[model samples]
Structure formats: C-alpha cells, structure tokens
Target: MSAQITLNARNLSRRLGRREVIRNISLQLKRGEVLGLLGPNGAGKSTTMQLLSGVLIPHAGQIEICGINLAQEPGRAKACIGYLPEHPPLYRDMRVDDFLLYAAKLHGVARSGLAEALAIAKSRCGLEDTGRKIIGTLSKGYQQRVGIAQAIIHNPDVVILDEPTVGLDPSQIRDIRALIRELGNAHSVILSTHLLGEVENICDRVEIMQRGQLIYGDTSVRMQSLGHQAGFIVTLQSPPEPAELYKVPGVVNVEALSATRFKILHSIDANTAEALLSLSAQQGWQAQQLTPLQGNLEDAFVHITQKQPNQHDQT
Candidate 1:
C-alpha cells in the first residue's frame, strides 16, 4: 500500500461453508476519504466489511493496512484500523464511561493516555454528559453514539462501520451521519449501507456491491448521474395539440396527462424548459405548473444492480 492509502485489498474472496459470499473484491481507501459500500440486502456488504476489517480471513487475496500486510502482521495492521460491526459490540450493563474505557484498552490505548482517549471519544460522539448512564438505559440513538465512540477511541488511521445508521430514527440518523463526516476529516472511513440517501449525503465515493462483486465504483456525484431522466412536467390552461408541443425546440416527446397537464421529455443535453415556456407564452397558452423531473439515485442504483450478473463462485 502507498503512504497515502490507508487500506488496500486485492481480489479478496471469502466463503461461508459451501457458499462464497465475497469474491474478487479489490478496494482502496485513501487517507481522510469517506467511502460508502452500497448494496441491497444480502448483497454481501457486511461480509465484505468483515473481510476488510480483519474480523474474518479471506479465502483468497491479500490486505494491507497503512503499508503493513494484514496476513503477515495482523496485530500491527489491525492496530491501525477501528471497526464497528453491524451489531455494535457493546455490553449493555456497563456504564458509558466503563464501556468506552474497556474499548480503548482493548485497542491498546496506553494506560497513560486512556483517560484522554475516553474523553476525546466521548466528546466527539456527543456523549460527554452520558458518561455515568448505563448503556442499556440510554435511548437507541445514544447507544449508537457510544458504538461510534468506541470505534474511534483509539484514534486509528482507518474506521470501518457496518450499517451505522441501520435502525436509527430520522433525527438519530442525521446526527450519526454528521459524526461520520467529521471522522472522514481525520481518518479513512468505510461505511457499509443499503441506503442510497446515506451514500449521496455521506460518501465521497461509492462502490456498488452486488452478488459479492463491485460492479461500479466512482465519485458519488458521477454515480448519481448514472440514470438520467431529462424532462419537465408542465400544466397548461389552454393547451395546443400534441403536435404543436412537439414543434418546440429540444422537445422530443410529449405525453398529455389530461386536457391541461403534460409530461414533456427532451434530449439528455437539451434545454427544453426555457424554449417550451416561451412557446407556450407566445401561443397564448397559460402555463400553470412546470416541474422539472430529476433522475433519482434509487433508479440509478436499481439500474446498475439489475444489469450485473451474479459474480460469486463463478470460477
């Protein structure tokens, strides 16, 4: 791995009994970058995260963490990585302070720096005032904060979170996402999620995992542009014939929803809205409602996943 790269995995494959759940997953995470591992349920995202975090050994391939070969030096490599599995490894009976202190110690935070480590983790996760609270007594959101706190307690170079926002409410999800973004400022973070909004909002780049294969990898902005729906919906009070609407520049297709409403489709690179409005005004047709249609990330995600074949255990 290069000095700038926090994690590098080549052709990682893993098998659970007779099923090969992960296959040829080559991935790289640069320092201070947030990468989202996006896939549908049963897409092997959690399995892949386990492989990358050293929680499970790959059946094939190699992994490097901060230039240290994980297979050769698991301790040294894992020392630079912080991982929070899909179910956070939390002891419900422990107090917030106690659990975090234990986590820091497990990660080998020096005894001398343990206090500061716990304090920093708590502070970063917005858990400063919940130190004395019992882990089980806290709400779901606070428990999740504690989960994230433990992951970063040792201040590792890489932080891997599997479905961090899985069951949180809207408010909790927002808060957790903000914290993850903050972590990306200092450490390489890999977030595994099935939520498209999480990727669009939290990730810098996205790897679409399907059938244990990375079918697509790119910046979130580019990934979002995969399926482009270029068009506008307009409602005109006095509409002309469908042929008249077709005569508008850049207007390739027009669908009449009713006597007044229309769904106008244009070329991907066309500027039809302005021209359509102008034409409607000039023709004395009153335009009531005009709504621009945008290509949804959900549509793009489905499009990409459906186009790919099952890649696991193909040999």
Candidate 2:
C-alpha cells in the first residue's frame, strides 16, 4: 500500500472535568483499512471516537480526515465521515424505511436521491428485510444495523463504529462482523470495542490504550515482530535436577509441572529433541517426548498489555 494516510491525529487530548481522558494520542488509518481501537473500560476508547467524529472537540491536538483538517474545516471533514455511537439513536415508533428516509434527508441527501440512498443503505446493512418493522419492535441486532445504515446513508469515505457488536447473539455477531469486513473493503473504518477476538479477526491494525494513554499502536504483522522465544513441553521417563536444567546453555528458565514433567523456556531456538536425547543418554535421564509451543497474537496482546508479564520493569 502507498504511504498516503486517510485519517491522522496528532497529540490528541480530551478532558472530562478535571481529568484528562485521552492523553497525547496519535494514530493513522489508511484508505479501505480497518483499525481496531481497544482498551479497558474508561481507557478512552469512547472519548477517542468522539474526538474523531467531531462530537467532542479536543482540548489539544489536530485531526485530519482525507486531507481535510477537522478543526479548520469541520463541515467538510464531517461530511466525509460517518459515526455510529454505542447506542443507536432511533425514533422507536418510526418504520425502518421511514427512519432511514429521515436520516438520509438529514445527511443532505438530495430529494431526488433520497429513495436511492435509503434503498442502498438498507440493502448494504441487511435492513431491507426489516424495512417495514417498527424500530421499537426490532431486535437489538436489527437496531444496531439500522444505526449503521443511518451512519452510512450519506456514503461517507470513513466510518466510525463504537461497540457495534455489543449485546449481539452469536449469529448476529457473525453477521455484523462479516458486514464490517465487507465495509472495510470499500471504506476506511475505525472500530472501537473491547472485543479482542473481533480485532484479531478483522483489524489490519490495532491501538491499545491504558489510563488515557496510547500504550501500543501497530499493524497486526508489526505487532507479531517480537523476537522468537521458544518453549518446549517435555514428558520425562525419569526425573533430573530441575535446577541443573536451568544451568544448561540456551535454557533461560525451567518450570517443573510434576516430578516427571517440565517445561523449558529459551530465548533461542535449537535442536531441542537432540539436546534432550543427548542429555538423557549421558545422564541416564528419561525423556519420553518434547514438543514446541507455537506463538500467536494472544501472546502479543498479553505481552503488549503486560497482562501477566514474564519480566519486570520493561519499557
């Protein structure tokens, strides 16, 4: 992909009362990409979305959408972006189609194009099946779909969704996730949610925030760039000195799960089975099996979030 970025924020900060909710945050999302905004509750996920959507002006910083400065050209910037908050803002008594028509008109959809815009939005979001249903009678998933439809009714270039899959059933969640994937193929998207699996599944990049500060922001591939740390699960035929195993070269740590079972940790990868066999033959050690443990994104998430750190005082 080109270096051209669609959304950029510099040193963004937002204050709620005396407390700063978002602190010196900066990130970028490219055209036709999906970025997951992940953080713990109160970690500024919602606050950051408001800043991006122009719902709340930042106390400090600059935001640009598709080369338009949001602060300098609010109208033009907002016209190119769509936002759906956690809760769908809907007239409960209005029919789905009627509500979409109202939303289209409010978005400056031309009178001549309202019908086309409404139909497109509904079809894109799978709301066509529920077009005549009253908003109040619709299920939570359908309501959320309506919210997304309204957001995209204007056909903005960028779409921001806050907790789009919250409270959804398994099928509904799958549907929404598929829809988000489809949307990301066409428009730049920012998805703010606590769902790590959803992020891992769909986001090209992710930004993790903690205590109002951005602790990590990186592409999925870049996040997995941590140097290899190897692990082996060993089943012993007989027990050896666990303490002595730690003294072996390349063996960083050893955790004994049982008198006959242990795990080996190393910062380097080598012929683990060869080492085990040689040691067993030399020391009369009984080694039945050894297997490598593959690493994955959950490992990266834990490492980045410091959820359960293996070491202390890491920067």
Tens-digit lDDT track of model 2 for 1-315: 584577999999988899988899998888889999887788899889989999999999999999999999998898888899988889999999999999877767889999899889989899878998999999898999999999999888889999999999999999999999999988899999887778878899988887788888888666655423577888887777787787566787789888888888876655555676687778877778787766656667767777523332454
Q: What is the per-residue lDDT of model 1 for residues 32-70, given as tens digits with 9 covering 90 to 100? A: 899999998998999988988898899999999999999
How do the predictions measure up, each by TM-score? 0.91, 0.83
- After the best TM-score superposition of candidate 1, give how far the Cα of residue 281 lies from its true spot, in angstroms: 4.7
Considering every candidate listed, which one attains the maximal lDDT? Answer: 1
Roughly what TM-score does model 1 have, to 2 decimal places? Answer: 0.91
The C-alpha stretches of model 2 lying farther than 4 A from their native spots are 1-3, 224-229, 234-249, 252-263, 269-291, 296-299, 307-315
